[model samples]
Target: MAIIFEEKQNIFHLQANDTSYVMQIIRDGYLSHLYWGRKINQYNHSNKLQFVDRAFSGNPYPSIDRTFSLDTLPQEYPGYGNTDYRNPAYQLQLDNGTTVTDLRYKSHVIYKGKPALEGLPAVYAEDKNEAETLEITLEDQIADISVLLTYTVYEQRNVITRTAKIINTGSASVDLKRALSVNIDFRDADFDFLHLPGAWGRERHIERQPLRSGIQSVESRRGASSHQHNPFVALLRKGTNEDNGEVFGLNLVYSGNFLAQAEVDQFNNTRVSLGINPFDFNWKLNPGESFQCPEAVMVYSHEGLGGMSRTFHDLYRTRLCRGTFRDKERPILINNWEATYFDFNADKIEQIAKAGKELGIELFVLDDGWFGKRDDDTSSLGDWFVDKGKLPSGLEDLVNRVRNMDMEFGLWFEPEMISVNSDLYRKHPDWCLHVPNRTRSESRNQLVLDFSRKDVCDEMIKMVSDILASCPITYVKWDMNRHMTEIGSAILPPDQQRETAHRYMLGLYRVMDEITAAFPHVLFESCSGGGGRFDPGILYYMPQTWTSDNTDAISRLKIQYGTSLVYPISSMGSHVSDIPNHQVHRYTSLDIRGDAAMSGNLGYELDLSKLTEKEKEVVKKQVSTYKEIRKLIQFGDFYRLISPFENNEAAWAFINKDKDEAIVFYFRLLSEANSPFESFKVKGLDPLKSYKVENTNDIYGGDELEFVGLSVPTELNGDFQSHVWRLKALK
Candidate 1:
């Protein structure tokens, strides 16, 4: 690993191997160094900022010098750079507000902060395999003011990445309320903010406010008071009703024992501020105590919120790129929960395997109700033994039977939870995360396992690994059915209670890291009650995630459209369930449902044995079509030609990487009141290039498609209908 510091360009590049993984880093126009492969704390208090001038001019500041001064600085100057700035050992202040001292200073101008701070540039490298990390530190003290910033940069692949841990090591915490604003060119008429619930499943919105100055704060708390305290705030600036582009700003304020706050200003000026808030805020940090806040990420792009989302996603992908599909075969899987529920034996699984083989399914997954005394959701959890009543021959025999049918066996495990009625909870009630003697709540008849405890995490990893090693299971569907309650950890020390959530997540990553290392070929899918845990963080370990429980074709159009804005289609699990649609209770045409499901990793969630003959035939043909074009749909670049939100009719197109073929799906939600023809002009194609169109029923080409876009004759008087066209570029 090498750290490349282009001093003249104000850019720091860290390269691990030979990849340009971490792209670029801008340090407010100051000399920045590239540190390589070093622990974070080594550079703590090393980087210092000199008070160069007052009356700063730039969006943040004209120069780093203008922002810090020694003489008469705020008495409570909160530390910057690192989150744990309240420690007196790291604090410094100017006597006469003139000069201070550097606690972790290495040189004159170079400052070191966390590796993540350099943004993308500091960690830029050529190849991820050989990439190294660089630790850079800087510090300056004149009079009473002292400032420090440290960063680390490294390369994992052909990508550059950087992470910064900013620490304001000063006697008086300074109000570092700063904003780094970037001007973005959005060429779209409307946009939306995508919100993913942490534990709550309710949908909230920040409507498009078409005016230049207003602040809206929405509070969301699903019965957790501490969670309800701080409301997420959004500020929108719209140019004009007719104007397409609008400037939006979001601010997340951190209060309580920690005094850090960040505000993003993008209306007249673009800037982001990270530091302590100055308004009526005074918190005492005991001698060795510390405070840390969540990271603040900003995105600016010309393609609206969807484009901005892609930027962040692309950044994550570049940093964490583990190839998917260990082998090159479509996973033909059957999840047994819907098939047999809690009633199944070795012979029962054998029967299902025989049926699946006849239907071309390649994997048999045993969902919940397999472990402990678990006949239902209420009983055993944490007890990872086979339920003798259900599977008398044990999991090994069941797995062998499925494998003998030339199919892979898979199993489901909610490792992060435990049923209160289980033996594990009965023996070690303190192991669960709850305030001592407080009421313990249960979701899905289970309590969350305290992953923050090393012993609990170890136990889970050991039991899960043992099961996989003992059986021929090739896949694992890891599910988390509920969000956290009680929010307290028994393992963490009293002072570190706030750190439990982060520690639990870290523990999860550790277990996964070990699992994937041992079983490289086994596939893992992360599910949080469905789509609750669908985020870039979870995607780091799993290739795909269950999209949502709502599989109604009509509702899914919007649900999936919103989902695709952030995730790739390959990562979405779209299953064809029985109509009178299970969740939404809306009946959709079988053809429409199959077509909608085809837009994702096509599969069935309904019981195949219960389907009518006609329905089964529809599924058989649907499966055939999916097998034929799954590759094109899976790996193709997607484009939203017409938004389902803007128009009643939803239209989307998928183009293969070669650009030789494309598929456009247009669904007419309802007929327009008086329009002669309910057709919309489709975009995202080369107008001059002639192409042949193939609908399942008919094929049309060249001149026949020249004037009018693909038309659908009124059916049921044009209430709700759909049309799909496969377009191939004519050679």
Candidate 2:
């Protein structure tokens, strides 16, 4: 294992055998650096840094670019003036005795005991166990100025893990509020940035209906502040109080300007905040405290998300994958949420499994309503016992029956939730999260379990783990229905109410960590109402996430786009839902729906038994084609050729390594009648190479294909038309 570091540039590279990863302290770079363009040094300010130009300047441009100043100082506490008193001026101790002063503008500063290099530290150990831990420390001198940047490398599969810390070494206590933001740059031509209405609420955009524009920002003074401005951008704030304790929580701020009311006793002098956004998870750190976050692991590929997710899975394959599998390829698994709603049982599930097998499905997941007398949302949550009435014989028998049909079996469980009518809730009413004497709220007839309590977490863990131990279940769909409200914990005293959320999340992580450690072969999919808890933190434990409940292809175009900005497609749980849609009542072509869903894990949530013969044949061919190119699709380089948000038509492409092969899926969402040629030009290809075109109307060489981008036919003749083109470069 070799780790390379470039001290002058503050850049670090890690290489383990054949795999390589890069990390840079991007103090002055913008979020746009990830995709829009390359960075080029045009003017050299000093030997330490340079003024660079951004290659791409479309969407996601950085807010600012400035020189980074370096300084050396003697150890001191709150040195000098009032505001600048905390800023430390240190000597770099260069070989030459000439001391350099005021290297950069000093912002808020603190004392760092020793000097650490900016680049990756070389690892002398040959094994994972022997690998030395690398630490890089820098004091942020600029007060109130947040260091924001995006980290990416040319090659895919280059796992980049980064963690930041604000060490409070000053004598006078300082209040620190910070955020970590990640902007994903895989903008395909078909990407559409969706804008939602209502503050902390959900809304969709319609083409023909009234475009409800110009809505004022409304602030909700509920338990926490929430505002919903645009669908893509969401801000949630977690804060601390005066005495240095945890306050606020994972508050979902949609689009509001209201400040959170501070509870007098709830204030803490030292704390950290957890911010959950659509793109990245941000955290706030205080003095003497350290927050460890999951690193952003990247996998480079010539393939797409399907390929990338498989690559990610391969990282922990030893502990996850199991059973007699067909080929190393992932099974074309189909879930039943969008297919048959909450109306499924043992016989119904077996029928779906049989039909799925006919469609070449490798796994059959019986989602929801499988246990605890959970026929409806109104009853039996928190109760983990298998409902013998639902399964009849037992869960093991159902799993074995599914396995007997030459398919893997998976089940869904909401271990963190309990219904008021549930046996568990009836037995321990105090276990659910709620304020005494207050009306307990319910979403989907469920309330969150008080995982902050050790007993609650332990019992839930045992219930879930025991089931996995008793059955040969290959997959577990872990779902959390709603965000927390009425934030109170029975285990904590009044002063520790603010600690409830953090403790709850920590407890959840603990249980998951133990479960994964014990049943290393079982794959778990983390889902929160569908993409709410989708963050790198959760991804560290679960390989994939349920992308969203909105299965409408048009809606998914935006949801998946925003999601892909920070997360890889491999971790996205996309499925072919009903055409008329289950969540959002939007009608999308089945072919387009399948193509869009295939971009992710490539599964179906709709009932295969209900499909028409033609639809079934199309699905069969789709499954066949997916198997042939699934690797490329799953592990390829993702480029956002065109954003569906910007254009009426949606277009995106995936290119394999060597740039030898590529596939572009274009959708003419809303047709324009009497348009000239009804086609659009594509981008991001080698203009010099000649290429063969597959599955397209026009055959062109690489030169022509590069110079004269393919012409995708318009859907003016019909709604929801699509074009699938395969290109092979001739070197």
Candidate 3:
């Protein structure tokens, strides 16, 4: 059984494959967290909450017991303004203007399968026996409000997902000041806080620090899970590394404004909370209406950060991402964004596609400026029709030109944006999100569409659908270039003005769900500038995301490495672009670039026709090699050997699930004079099996390769150099 309820002790223990989460109903029916870590046969109730008489710790039941205070208990979903001064998991304001809520255990139900979150993206169980869910109801009698906390545990993965539903069971409406998804308390604050923080182009860089006395957090208030901070955080025990110790990771499956925080109290206990950012946010729950927060995924790993990452990779790659392309090997495509940008004609696009087909590329993507007289970024965003001047033969003619070359075709669309110069904008001036009489700020000469309005979403769906249905487009690069500004929905009421951001997210999801469902054969890749909206929410509709706009090989070493902490390799759209690279203007070797991009879904963003004959040969070889190993790279278990953040070198490997094949990639950013000899050690290999190294007569036991490690080539010299090794078991 994945979940066990000890009735007498009132303890609820949820067990994943190798981890466990235990909580119990304590004094006065308060739900408190007990333990979360390595799995055990049974929780002995040894980690019980301690009742103490502390000064200034307000107690609701002071007359019954002065020592029993909610302030000291390690609560599962803590309430605000009821003595616990730490940040709350949720908050509510009654019609009488009091911001106090006391939630006590009411009832609970355990089920075999996990239920889906209404209108939200979440990890799901395909089979009933694959997971179990426990829904516990906590209610405040005075406010007539009930908070239902849901926990789902995967039977074979070290993952547990949490969500909360706030229901107003009274006649009066209540304002939800804060409705965070999940919260947990730890007994001590001796852990290191780890998060991914970076700016645009250089996204998801790893940052770690020791937990201080105050609150430390990573959040995105830019109306997106912005490139500034990813919606994920982890607590690592002291001395933990990639392959050892313990870690607790929490990732929010949301793309809008969010917050992930860890607060260390004076007593040294740590409280971790994750959910929607309460900044400029509130939800009005009317009678019989309930609001569901986005799901928060929690992963516990005793085998270190690598184990935690692998658990996330496996779960997300299979369960979280859905579509025709989810399990399939991604195509080797060439995107013409960098090759042609906004300066391409139909003939120029075909020339690049022709060069790509000759070099073994399987797909050709025609990027921005193909539609609606859009010669540059300043105009024609929402008008999805083809520009007659650029594509005189129409979009179908261009798609057919590429399809006739035995290669698939794809197109790029900034569906969530509108230019002031667009015909669509001229037709419906109120389509863009803005307050009346306010200056609508524009980024890249585009304004965000008011997706909170269903009419606007329906029009977008129709426009995009018409194009997809009119051609043989097999892939789409759905791009959103800017963040929200002047975020007000004209259709919403004054009381719900703050609901614009979240409502827009919901509308975007609805559009994606409808469009993707209509065209199941199409492979959709999400982008926000690049990697700006790269969160689990978008991954649910689109299998992969353009990892970043910065394709510099040396730069990607850190970007991709940090991204792998939570996202799977299959979910990252990595491509090799020309150098002096477009984003950073740093020159790196083509071989090095190919090596970096090959670690994920391999593609190219450079003009294939511009490469010399020798470079063409190298590109051909890279394509062939990726095809040979793409299955393993996409579906294998990944391990991080060295980090680019901490070392001058970065090393990672992928081993198939059957343990018969493995691939290792080692990179050196800059060469050293007279450097010490090094061997790249790898994990997840079968020790007893003998394997043959590809391209060599070398045969060795897996034990020898894993323990003794592989020797790094001494002749490798220069900045931004890399090496790859392939191993196949000698059956």
Which candidate number maximizes TM-score? 3
Candidate 3 per-residue C-alpha lDDT over 391-486 given as tens digits, one digit per residue, 9 for 90 to 100: 998999999999999999999999999999989999998989999889999898999999999999999999999999999999999999899899
Show how many residue pairs clash in every candidate, following the order shown.
Answer: 111, 69, 0
Give the alpha carbon lDDT tens digit for every residue of 311-379 in model 1. Answer: 434444343324446223347566766667787777766776666666666677788888898888897
User: Which residue pairs in model 3 clash with each other?
Assistant: none
Cα RMSD (angstroms) for every candidate in the order listed: 9.2, 12.6, 1.0
Q: lDDT tens string, model 2, 247-293? A: 11111211111221111111111111112121111223333444322
RMSD value for candidate 3: 1.0
Q: Given candidate 2, what's the lDDT at residue 657?
A: 58
- In candidate 1, residue 338 scores what lDDT? 61
Cα lDDT listed for each candidate? 0.52, 0.52, 0.93
Off by over 4 Å in 2: 1-329, 683-688, 695-699, 714-716
User: Which 10-residue window in model 3 sums to the lowest lDDT?
Assistant: 45-54
| Model 2 accuracy (lDDT, Cα) | 0.52
Candidate rank order under TM-score: 3, 1, 2
Worst lDDT run of 10 residues, candidate 2, spans 262-271
